[model samples]
Target: MAKKVKVTDACQGCTLCTMTCPSVFAMNADNLAEAIVAEIPEGEEAAVEEAAANCPAGAIEIE
Candidate 1:
């Protein structure tokens, strides 16, 4: 199945996700990183997973 990505409340406004996957993640007005889209785009699963794994706050969620 396709992967779904989102940022949890634990986000510390870190830009790691954005830096890791600019296409799938971006910083919102609150400075927290959020998923640019609900569903991971084709071939971008690895990048999203990496972002989630690298997130220091463990805010990134991939389901």
Candidate 2:
């Protein structure tokens, strides 16, 4: 099953995740990157992990 990742306080709104994976990350109204996984199809875990790994602020958490 696909898991969900969330953006937290550590986020600096750098948008690195969004650039790395536009399929799963988006810039919210607050200008912070939010991980929207509800629409994510299966077999995309690695991409999510890449986003988490690329997040410089350590704000992305996979649940």
Scored against the true structure, residue 7 in model 1 reaches a CA lDDT of 93
Candidate 1, residues 1-63, lDDT tens digits: the string is 788999999999879889889999999998888898999999999999998888899988888
Clashes of each: 0, 0
The local distance difference test score of each candidate is: 0.90, 0.82
Estimate the lDDT of model 1. 0.90
- Candidate 2 local lDDT, 1-63, one digit each (tens): 667678888899998889888888899999998877664557667877888998889998888
TM-score of 1: 0.93
| Residue 23, model 1: Cα distance from true site in angstroms | 0.7
Over 4 Å off in model 1, which ranges?
none
**Candidate number of the best lDDT:** 1
